[model samples]
Target: MESSDLRNAGLKVTLPRIKILEMLENSDARHLSAEDIYRRLIEMNEDVGLATVYRVLTQFEAAGLVRRHNFEGGHAVFELERGPHHDHMVCLDSGKVIEFVSEEIEEIQQRIAAKHGYDVEEHSLVLYVRPKNRVAGKVGKG
Candidate 1:
């Protein structure tokens, strides 16, 4: 992903966009909300406004460079488009996200769509889970 790609998509390559993209690129988390991104940016001393982060994220979503997810209540989160399609499992207690690929689930989805005579364009699946008492370092699969 390059900044010029945004320009090609008719979006101006602004500092906030660049910084947000960079942070997203370097992030290990699979899901990040606008507030989370803003906090990270502030920690880096970028000082970009939260609204700016949200606007840039919306632009990125419109450009198809990022995907927005609503796994945790009304707050929206984003993830970069990378590899094959997958779903998410969010830990309710820790707010950790886990990515998992399930062929069985995929087949079931396809069958359901076919049964309804509808070609699936796009879809998102998010499972909310609670971890057993383990106090693990991180609570998610890649």
Candidate 2:
């Protein structure tokens, strides 16, 4: 999404927004919550409030700069929606997120939508899976 889009949405380009965007840009983890983002901002010595973080996230989502995903839980996660679309695989044990793209899945989705005569605007696919073995990898951001 364009930075100008934020301006057009009547949101001032504040330091917190810029910093939050930077963190999201550099992060390998595709999804993060407002609390997750606020914690990171604190680690970076940014004096941004959690409420402000939530506001900025909502603004970004409105501007189509970020997408929100809920992986079978109460807390929602945010991810920068750039490039092509993809689905997620979340490890139930560790909450690790993996991004995977599949043309077959896309085709299937399109076919289903067409069969119902519905146009898909936006969609989310999250697979919550636990490791077959108890030996799961480290917990934290992916």
Candidate 3:
């Protein structure tokens, strides 16, 4: 998102907002915590505060510019709201978040919802998983 996108979202186009939005738009990691953003900003010598990071993230969530996921036993993470429908697999050991889409699962969910006489308006699926062949005392991220 750019300055114009922020203005379109009814948010003022400020330096902090622009920097944060650029981080979200360009980061390789799809999901990130406020602290993560704050650390990166600090690394880049930006003077944005942690509180400001939190506030901006909250505003972004409220404005539908991002989505927050509160995975079990972890701090909330935010992702840009610009992707296709997909489910998440959170690695239990490494806290990695993997996104996937399966037509088979979607069809089965539709069939089950239809059998129950309810249309599937929306749904979210998160599967907490660990590596099947995990090496002892090792962790991996995806």
Tell me the lDDT of candidate 1.
Answer: 0.87
Candidate 2 global CA lDDT score: 0.85
Residue-level lDDT tens digits of model 2 in 48-83: 999999999998898778898877854899999786
Please provide, for model 1 over 1-142, each residue's C-alpha lDDT reduced to its tens digit, 9 standing for 90 to 100.
7888878878998889989998889888867889989999999999799999989999899988899887756478899978699998988877888899999999999999999999888788989988787676767878
TM-score of each prediction:
0.84, 0.82, 0.90
Instruction: Name the 10 consecutive residues with the lowest summed lDDT in model 3.
Output: 133-142
Model 1, residue 109: distance off in Å is 1.3
**Candidate 2 segments exceeding 4 Å error:** 1-5, 8-10, 135-142
RMSD of each: 6.5, 6.2, 4.9
Ten consecutive residues with minimal summed lDDT in candidate 2?
1-10
Overall lDDT per candidate, in order of appearance: 0.87, 0.85, 0.93
Best by lDDT: 3
Q: What is the lDDT of residue 63 in candidate 2?
A: 76
Write candidate 3's Cα lDDT for 1-142 as tens digits.
6789888889999999999999998899999999999999999999999999999999998888999999899999999998588999999999999999999999999999999999999999999999999887767896
The regions of model 3 sitting more than 4 angstroms off are 135-142
Clashes of each: 0, 0, 0
Q: Which residue pairs overlap in candidate 3's backbone? A: none
